[model samples]
Target: MNSKLIKELPDLVRNNVISQEVATTIEAYYQSQQANSPNRLFTVFGVLGSLLVGLGIILILAHNWDNFSRTVKTGFAFLPLIIGQLVVAFSILKHKSKTWKEASGTFLFFTIGSSIALVSQIYNIPGDLSAYVLTWVLLSAPLIYLLKSNVLAILHLIFITFYAYEIGYGHYYSNETPWLYLVLLGIAIPHYIQLLKHRTNDNITSLFNWLYPLSVTIVLGTFVKDLSELGFLMYVLLFSVFYNLGKMPFFDTQKLRKNGYLIFGSLGIVVLMLIMSFDSFWYIEELVFFAQESYISILLFFVNGVILGLAYYKKWLQSFNVFQYVFILLSLLYLGGLNLPVLGTVIINILILALGITTIKIGADKVHFGILNYGLFIITALVVCRFFDTNMSFVIRGLLFVGVGLSFFLTNYIMLKKQSSKAKTL
Candidate 1:
């Protein structure tokens, strides 16, 4: 059957027009199952069940390790861990080992590592969170390399993430935490090297898949914390990531499927916008731009100009989105530099109207995707500004609101017409 028929066949079966066996057969024939790896549902359940039992043992030991002697407990303390390490070594040695052996060995090392540390805490080991995370991460790294197991790599990466997220975000600054950054980079290097050489292991790729952006964002966020002025700079940095990724020659579908550079970058942009909604990242406040702190204001303006210039250079200049920040900078200059402090409210309304009208014109005449966003920008800006600017004249403001309301339907119609015309040209 054709694609349409195949799609409809599922619904037909679901509606009880076909038998379940027949449906299953059709699905299997249409979707070929890869034969390299056999199904391992039982193996997975066994591992999970064993892990739970192991965890129960650790909790019991953690609570009652005090009654045992130093030598007896020391041997006992390392017994599970030593055994786990040996199992990992054995699994690695057997190149043709089954997946269960490989997975179980990695799982045992992980369990033993954590359990040993918890037991160590019973002996009153006095290490900080960073030190603790570092120790565990180092111990686990070899399992990743020796076994070439993503589970081991992923486990190490998870603990490394915890180290960075918990301690890095909450404390410390400067080059002192270079060790922590190094550990994170260490976790990434093996996978990055592999992903470049071979994009076959989707699971390993998926781990870095998440870990890279997460690690990058965490690092960057740590760098720019507590700096409102630098928040705009952070957006520029984030967008630069998107601009690069969207241009990269690599066609690995896994990269797009698992990673979210755009989502993270967009979040950074939104935060910058919200901060600018009050203090204005690119310029001084609305009414007071003329008498700005000249040095700081100029530096910030130049920074914003650089961001827009990069965006334009990359040809990623989505109209209203790029201009949202640009307008914040401009609106500051337009209202404050013009010596019209009392007319601030009027200027904001006028600004919204201008954006809406420009959108309609752009779609109608210019044939641009960026233009599609302009009316939404104006409408949202009007709504937001009105909510905060409580001192404005009611009558004049009421008229502006009504005027923008009418513009909405008109702009939609114009953009639709423009889009239809553009489609014809295509």
Candidate 2:
């Protein structure tokens, strides 16, 4: 419903372009459409306002903290929580709009944590920061589904990631593994699934697309207790999983920018390959296989194999990029490197070079500027790696750089000329 069109309806009627009755109907129809549209700004501001107000209340209470009696402090601690709960209850019982549910739910979420912290402080309760965060996360997890709030769901993910870091990395001497992080992540999956099924194109759904993989990427390192060398293998497998998941029908249709899994997976493999190409990386003193401490990495390897098997069964391999299947080659190279380090180094360097050329070919076939530039970047990066790692003369290294630069210019120019020719013919 264009406002300009609505305004011109009367003029159209007066000019005999339409009857008065028709003009009135058109105006009414547009007015109804405008009314039915969701107010995105209002929802955003409402959530922000609720968040700021909650923080403000805490700040205000903190300012006059020492002046208040113990009983007064106790009352103040629960006041915000009680108010937040009531608001959330009203929003739920009345079946309020999305804005109301989100605003109230966000306000209540912070209040629960603030109240918990205040009570612990006032009563001299004993607990570590990790325990406090776990409590806050658990209490607020239900709010995500109860109010159907995307904000709460995102917050839950952040808190869980924080909790994982606190337990796994923050406590150096503690033997606690962040295994609970996986369980907490699993609890949030149904909500994400619902979003995938019903709100596939939503902005929140896109946010989840980025966060889910990033969270796992960050947390996967926590599982490495010993045999740290195997960590690299674990990461490669994880990225492979992400890449294949992104190739599924639902994710494949999305724009490249929105497909975080594909982006992360491809970039991860390329970076790992580049690192492993160095001759120094293959010089291992001791090689351990199937160690008890390396179970997480082993399990991940099997999981990646299963995923690859499924991808093959589904015939996805035909459309996959070279990097998608490069993990297998790298795995074998790692095993062979245990005995023949120099050979492994040579093969990896050759593999990277071949990968760059293949990528360039794919880019030429697709006529995509981004893909073409990415392929060029891979070659450029490989050249840069050799510049430092090899004992080549300075003049030769400079010539290599110049050659890569020339290729970039010529490749892009040819691509643009081809595109122009097609445009003109069309």
Candidate 3:
């Protein structure tokens, strides 16, 4: 029970709602439950302490490092790694301690990177940032498995994505083959899977939730160079994959941020559709042709279709989500290309308005303020966007804005009144 309910127990006992013995038993049970809960603060501090100590050691060693000879410098570079390895090994073998495991794992992870940097700096290695990051990620990838460390896994995932982005877009401006990052990414997936399997609701699991989607988002843009116009299709299909994953049992239980795939996927599709609704996207001058890489987009579409089909078959997709169906209409609009730009824009605008109304109705029925406000925000944004377009008359735009504002106030007022009435009845 919560604090309010617990506090009310004494009053109930005093009124003879239950005996003193029963009240005592209930209090004792809850106290035991509280005692058994994990200490998250301790874990946070332990991880922070480990990072600070590791950085401190590196800073301390860097003081007057020019005085050391070649052999001495090499030995110094490896010293932290050796120490970190020993600490991690001891944590694994000698104790059943999460703090020790996390601390040592974090230290070792950084130490490995530091060792590589020191060696590179000592020898004047010739490579770009991408190469450096790839090496660091490769070195640290093993720590995830060795220490069963989610922190290291998450860090490695981030680094590998950085490597991919830097190699693909940052270095040389037009690097064609950045596929090695996918191999590196594949190595990190097993650790994430293991974390999910073992401690599905742990803080680390939550971190993985954010990290995986972020990694995908980071690497997603790199495909545009080769795929060209088909990149948009790839993105739509990728978002569909994320949406399907969000409907999975694991992600379904998570909060909005933790369910990054679903949130990003849904919002991504909506935003893309909205952007595509404009005249610029449908203009004849902006026409796009099929590229060889467009086949990849087709493959992704098929994959997305299979996943959505399975979801429908399994009844996982209950009601129509505005995001889910917008893509089909978007694909149709894309097929229309420059021929029916005006019609396409009209259809998309109507679709957005219809979607906003549908979302508001669903939210009101469910009594969900967040969903209701989300719908209102969409309508407000659509109206605001039209303000920039000179094609629409000022008087019509003003009316649109006024209508949206009134709807917001009226919908919220009615919902509030209903909620108040229900509370009074209760």
**lDDT of candidate 2 over 1-426, digit per residue (tens):** 679998898889989999999988998898898787657789899999999999999999999999999999999999999999999999989988999999999999999999999999999999999899999999899999998889899999999999988887897776677888999999899999999999887677888999999999998877766666777778888887788788776887787777888778878877888998888888765656766336765676677778778878887676546666776887777866875668987898888887788778877877888878888898899889888889999999999999999999999999999999989999
Residue 183, model 3: lDDT of: 93
lDDT scores for all predictions?
0.55, 0.86, 0.77
* Ranking of all predicted structures according to lDDT, beginning with the best and ending with the worst: 2, 3, 1
Q: Write the residue-wise lDDT of candidate 3 on 353-391 in tens digits.
A: 777787787679777787788889877877776678657
What is the TM-score ranking, best to worst?
A: 2, 3, 1
> How does residue 183 of candidate 2 score in lDDT?
91
CA RMSD, predictions in order: 8.6, 4.5, 3.0
Q: Worst ten-residue run, lDDT, model 3?
A: 284-293
Name the regions of candidate 3 deviating beyond 4 angstroms: 1-38, 194-203, 248-250, 284-293, 422-426
Residue 275 error, candidate 1, Å: 2.2
lDDT of model number 1: 0.55
Cα-based lDDT at residue 56, candidate 3: 91
In model 2, the runs with Cα more than 4 Å from the true position are 1-37, 285-287, 290-293
* Between candidates 2 and 3, the lDDT winner: 2
- Residue 358 miss distance in model 2 (angstroms): 3.3
Best by lDDT: 2
